[model samples]
Target: MTSPLSSSPAWKALLAHRDALAGATAADHWQASPERGAAFTFPCAGLVVDFSKQPVAPETLALLCALARERQVPESIEKLFTGEPVNVTEGRPALHMALRGDEHAKVDGVDIRVEIQREREHFRAFVEAVRDGRWKGATGKAISAVVAIGIGGSASGPQLVLRALAPDHEGPQVRFAANIDPAELDQALAGLDPATTLLVVVSKTFTTEETMANALAARAWLEAALGPAALAHHVVAATSRPDRAIAWGLPECNVFGFAEWIGGRFSLWSSAGMPIALGLGMAAFDHLLAGAHAADLEFRSTPLERNVPALMALIGLWNRDALGAPHHVMLPYAARLEGLVLYLQQLEMESNGKRVTTTGEPLDRPTVPAIWGAPGTTGQHSFHQWLHQGTEAFACDFIVVAKAMGSDPDRHARLLAHALAQSEAFMDGLDVPDAHKACPGGRATTTIVLPSLDAMHLGALIALYEHKVYAQACLWGINAFDQFGVELGKTLAGRILPAVRGENAALTPATHHLLGIIHKLAQSD
Candidate 1:
């Protein structure tokens, strides 16, 4: 039988190596290194990755790679390409790669090429119709605006892609509403005419509470404006359960479907990207897919010692498991990339934030760290102080773009400078005679340089992180695809909602007390 990950030889050797390197800092390696530490940077999928500031020695890397070999990271990657049901718990293959035109990708012994291509054509026809003014709203006017609705995976990925790729959107004006908050939908619908607006309701099951609530509200809003018959023309759906969507009032022509093998968080490349295609055009969307496919090739074929995502995953394991760091920060220099952090939070946390393994045994070591951060320069003002002097030990991933979204050379130059300066300050501290002025240095950071913020690069960046999440999950023996942990609260919320709506449902005393206060407050309204 295979040993537990904690008791494996490579893991034990690392534990010993951890004791061997005491009192050394990342700064120490920088000064004593050759080539001014330039060798630490690796060119990967069009980005330059520098791990010099991670505070790991050559021996540390060798041991970590050994651990990866023992964990069979390469084989895990192969299974993904070969369409194995790596997501064992769900009994499904997490083959989002098929969404990007992977010819060999499959599910249930059927190659997805023919099916995925057919779906792609259907997805394109709808998006092209809307973009080219061929599809009209209930009032027989070409759609000029869109309100995209869905929560979590259905929402975050496409929302971020459109924001990052199309800042000045020249196509149909697309606004996204993900939160169940009435204000979010209200804001998205504000000042837009129902006559010319289209709604893309994205949900895998077509019954997610938050998504359906928002979709129904938006449908009602449209019905009030254009009448009940108009919704057949006004609302479009991207879901696996087209029957539920059709039962809920969408026309059969308005429904687009993806396979059960696709997860929501990874669904942006699927029919979930309907909004992205409408907002950014099919050409841009295709470029995004191409970039991700390129990265997939790199991740699937590259050697373990130098693979980009593998290195990212291993270094992350070292930080969380060996150093005991509990959190990681992603600081993107471009503001449009702000959603990148939100997207990653769900990708890393929801995927690997588990207490149990794939077999349902307790996990012995830490997995993914709590992921959080804002866009840089802005983040510099918000959290730089704490990062520089805070008692907490955490890792930072900084994203630096060679050129920004704008054409102002001076502004981009200064933005790049600030990112570099902050990264340097993070790795090396200053000595001060004043006790209050001293800065704690030696914080580990990994800086990634994006060639530019185009669709291709953005796709590669997102896919790179996806593989990183998968690699870490493989190491932890966790089910990266299933999220049973999130289901209980949603189920309980379903039970609790009726009680809050004046029903005589039984409740805990504290909940009743809170509900009473809320009800009493409503009386004043």
Candidate 2:
């Protein structure tokens, strides 16, 4: 595969082709055919994705697919699924697909299927024991609340899943603490009895400072209230480093480990999602995995045009490369899916926000757009103003559910209508007489309409985006797995800790000055 540069033959063709398409608009495409929506739509894992609002002609779609082929996307995808070391810098395979409960997945001669299933069963038994009052704390009190401690993907993914599937919860109330700030953990523990609280500590290495601090603090709180033995009964871990967990005084049986092959952003499908299983029950969790597996199968087998992930990737590439969009926005109309944007923001930005290509050469093209968004109705009042008439261009995705769970029919109908209205308004902006009222209405959006918000659909939705990120990474020749960009901060923070405490001579002038101000403020306090 060749580097995807402006000078490449395929990219040059696309550049010339885009010039010819300069006059084309979303409105023009919509008006070209009444069946335009149907023509551009694809169904996968029970979600119907409508991409008609995107300004792409049939020829353009073909050319995009050709570009993908030119970049060897198919070969890349095979490497992704077959556990090749696609994460070249780290020399690890991004085999998150194995976490979706596939019974036949093998990576590096190890049957990941057996391992995943074993962990699933272990998770199920533990959840059942806790929920059924068989597993009690040191005080013999039934666990009533679970404090999930982790940061970033570890915390956000399960938090999102637990919140979305709360109705299916037959277990303890799940609370989340992701921040390094002590207040976050304190707030989560508020109103919950230490004797009845089980802390779930999650980190791949079991050494993330924020998570470990929160875990140890929670342990102290529990031990203070329930005695030292409470640590054994009240704390469990989801980690890839069981030896470290055991050394930290956690019982061997209480430590659940997943493969190191799972990236933190993609670890939710593994035992890192234990909190989700505990909150949503194993059945709902299974549905989530099954839904993702279904989407994965489709992504692996379907053609570029027919594949939902492929089309989404191509549209995203088109928006970035051809239309010159600098940002991507997500809007989920369902209130239950409020965390969707946060989850995807990390998934997209952390995965593909790279300046270099896979071959160690600097990339000349943009990788990922600045991904951001919030839930609808509330967002309608907040950032929708900028989305409507803002000067910057955006490639937006509006996710809606046809039948909302527990919502009144009229209210659900209104929600659906508002979602469609927003998409239409973006595509066909108001051409009113007043300058302020005019919406320069050619902004592109893709609407994802699900049958309803359920574990299955949510799983499929997340997996679709995962595959889409992979497809886009292939086109850009970047590794979507390794995240070296985030490590520098942690490294710097460790070196700065001593400076922040007192010493300023060893630090840079700017950092020393900042630390001096912080120390001065602290002494005043």
Candidate 3:
């Protein structure tokens, strides 16, 4: 695992630029110099990225571009698109891109297009059956609602997509329960007919604690009303654990499996995307994949300086390391993209939130910042105050669809107005003589404008973030594929569960005292 950064001319150039940045201050440059913007070119998925707002100089941009070139980023992008093994730690090709239209990509001389087509056919059939009255519950009722149960990637992707594309939905209403909280499950199932609801359990392994717990709770609610036989009618699973699902009373036919090579966050193009497919239909799903593939083509063919993903990655590194920013915000103005912030939080943080690199060496640079954000109008009412007046220099993204999906013309105008207004405010702050009232005008912000809020644009938006994460991982010299950080908490929970159940032997004095207090409090309640 030789690092792409170490033995390359690009690395040397970047090092030189980094050194050059020390003497420059925010006071010296309030606006991004034209020379800086001219030094970088942007390319991706029919989207034009403007990275001129970043603090990087022309020399720095050239250095970053050289680093990307030295790292064989173009070749790596091609490898990823063609199903080569880029996920080194996992020893698998991250071929989520193949789930899109990879007609030219072949595995062992077998075209991936056929498999994708077959899977889509299966999805369409299932969706049509459910959408029409052809697929009936045991009680002979049409499904009026859907509950998607899963944690992390399984939950985040579909949940975000559904929320963003809600205006286009014409089928059953969909709800999601991903947390381990009983309250979330209770609320999701509340007022839903047991015989008229479908529960789509999504986990690569059908054994995720939160997903299974929520599934079982939903099952119990259904059985309490519709009887045990209703399990077959109410439950469907998107997982490789078909045996487990069958053993748990789900029909084998109801189990859908995706390949192990597809990471959860990237699995939306696979069967894990069934919920989204059902909500939006096969045409929209294909459009989503097509948009991603479009970006994939751009990323693979474009040069480093002209690469949108690479430039986005370099700008992020500049903000985090050079500009001393500790946070990155994803603020989409469209209410439909409300869940996008949460999706990106997991995608970026869980992928790169590491202290060590791929080969067990401690990283000298910061890995990931606190990735947090919300939708526009709501965020404006809440945390926009801190974002505007706060001392900390947080890097922010303002995402807006050029045109509103909503039919209300006045509402759409207001939405776009707020979107444009916020970015303007961030770039040119309010002025007051008093220190408390004075606003910092030089705060950095990036605006991502989409053509529209259709499935294609949303797909492109997500793919952009995905590629940006990949490029950043390459720059930081870490494996973005594996997530060992999530394992430690699972291990700790196993040890604590027995104690929680009062089945453990001698406890530590502190634990025993806490147990006594808990028991007393329980009795009092």
lDDT values, one for every candidate: 0.88, 0.88, 0.78
Best-to-worst ranking by lDDT: 1, 2, 3
List, residue by residue over 164-225, the lDDT tens digit for candidate 3. 88877888888889999899988888899888999999988788888888888888888999
Segments in model 2 whose C-alpha atoms lie over 4 Å from true places: 503-505
Per residue, candidate 1 scores C-alpha lDDT tens digits across 255-320 of: 999988889999999999888889889999999998898888889889877888999999999989
Indicate the TM-score of model 1.
0.97
Q: Which one wins by lDDT: 1 or 3?
A: 1
lDDT of 2 by residue, 1-525 (tens): 537567677778887888998758879976777778778888999999988889888888888888888888888888888888888888899888887855475677776777777877887888889888899888888999999999999988998888777778878899999998999999999999988899999999999999999988988998889888778899999999999999999889899988888999999988889889888777888899999999999999898879899889988999997788999999999888888889999999999999988888888888899999888878999999999999998899999888866747988888788888998899999999999889988888999988988999999999999999999998888889988889999988989887766664378889877877877888894
Error of 3 at 237 (Å): 0.9
Off by over 4 Å in 3: 1-12, 18-43, 104-113, 430-432, 505-517
Displacement of the residue 515 alpha carbon in candidate 3, Å? 5.0
Candidate 2 vs candidate 3, lDDT winner:
2
Q: Estimate each model's TM-score.
A: 0.97, 0.97, 0.91
For residue 335, model 2's alpha carbon misses the true position, in angstroms, by: 1.0
User: How many residue pairs clash in all the candidates, one count each?
Assistant: 0, 0, 1
Instruction: State in Å the error of residue 503, model 1.
Output: 1.1
